[model samples]
Target: MPYKPTVVLSAIEEHHSDGVFTHTTVSRARAAMVRAVQAIYPLYFETMSRPPIEVSDLMARDGEKVTVLVHRHNNLFRTPQLIAVEGRIITTAKATPLGLIIKGHRNRGIALAPTELVDAVPGWGETAISALRARCEAVRALLPRETAPLTAGAISAIPDDTADAASCTTVLLTSTQLPYEDPVHGCLWLVSDRTPGSGEDILNGVLLAPPTSSLVSEHGSIYAGQLPPYTAHLPTAAALTYAEALDLAGAINGKDPSRGYLSALARLDAQL
Candidate 1:
């Protein structure tokens, strides 16, 4: 007898108006179809193995806070004159006698100031503040559905130029991870940056997979969105190291290594 495909069996099962076929016969046919497909495509039926390293996996294992470093860019200023931190873009406003007031739809047009606004323009006061509030709303709308709510906090702003050292900014970490299209593999990596663009430099755009790995770091350089001559941000305890970053890329590519340096680091850090 000739083999029957699932597509044909499914059609027959759907058009059983004649009531000549029994449920048992139909079930057997469906089962046979599944087996045939599996036999023909065993590779596709096999389970997709997990990567050696993943951001969530590392976070779960380490329980350490990952520091996402975002480079200040002009594109961020284009939308809402906002600053990116961790996973959010935020603007600062002063607390008036009434309270901290932000005029925008996201904040319901008025909100108590979380902290004193820094980098406040001198001449452009309320107008500037209102514009920023609007911008904040616009950026908020772009947030992915899986993102957590925007949480207010403080962050360190590292200047791109060596002449200027790191400064502090009272900002919010949206705690929301933005999805970036990795040009290299055409996969999606959740990155933290307020502005959208390409490049490895922190000043060029956003950063991904912290503690060592960045969207454009040499250790694991996963982001293909930006152009070449990729320069990575410095690695810190809060970010992925070069080896760990590579492992992460490997994992994303469905390559699981027996052991990764990140696991060793975690073990060493635990001992300390």
Candidate 2:
């Protein structure tokens, strides 16, 4: 005889008033029933001193009510290993040529008479399964998005006083906008002189110049600062040049880029 993986057979009947079953409904019902059983049985076993009572011992005596069983197997060295076991209850004890048939929620299966069955939890029946399924579905519906959105933040320097600042030419740059592209090498210029129209003058300059005298002449209205222009929509190549120029200028002024532009760049890199 071929060895069949041990399956537990119960003697319970699931009756539908409509007496109709569809493939989809039956599959769903079986899954729900299994989930219900799995959830309840663990808690029920935890209450016992020696939980998961063995199937052989539970089936030794007749008329003993059992809801779950712990199926045990032996390894190569004969060490007992516990494996997951499922049991079903049949509705009738009639001796048919195949075996006794058991019906679960929207499903049925055949099992032999005098089957080795054990119970783990009492009152574990189709009604309990249905109730548990409903509760699980309700809880699932209340959950938020399957995955949460990612968030990020950063802190950098900004100008403390815009008017009449004699100490430093530029203050730290701080903005919520992210710099997606590298700044133009030598073209990244900022004006911290607090001139009447310095902001507009800085904005008008062409980005990423090759550090020529004409480039400075074009935007000579305001004194240039070491900080890079952080305005959006600059091309990547230009942004790179500006970033390099900002770093060089910062180095020449003996100011650590981390105190300003470097910090902002680090935050953007983290997001990526």
Give the candidate number with the greatest lDDT. Answer: 2
User: Where does the lowest 10-residue lDDT sum fall in candidate 1?
Assistant: 3-12
| The best candidate in terms of TM-score | 2
RMSD, candidate 2, Å? 26.1
Per-structure clash totals for the candidates: 10, 27
CA-lDDT, candidates in order: 0.24, 0.28
User: Given candidate 2, what's the lDDT at residue 160?
Assistant: 30
In model 1, pairs of residues that clash are 51-251, 71-202, 100-113, 210-239, 210-240, 211-238, 211-239, 211-240, 212-239, 212-240
List ranges where model 2 is wrong by over 4 Å: 1-33, 36-40, 47-50, 63-272
Q: How far is candidate 1 from the true structure (C-alpha RMSD, Å)?
A: 27.4
lDDT (tens digit, per residue) of candidate 1 on 1-272: 42111111120233454689544212322222222221112121122232222222222222122211111112311211123111112223331321211222233222212221111211223454454344334322221212111121100132333433222111111111236732221111222222222433332222222221233312211232232211112111233233443445454333422122223223222311
Q: What's each prediction's TM-score?
A: 0.18, 0.19
Prediction 2 global C-alpha lDDT:
0.28
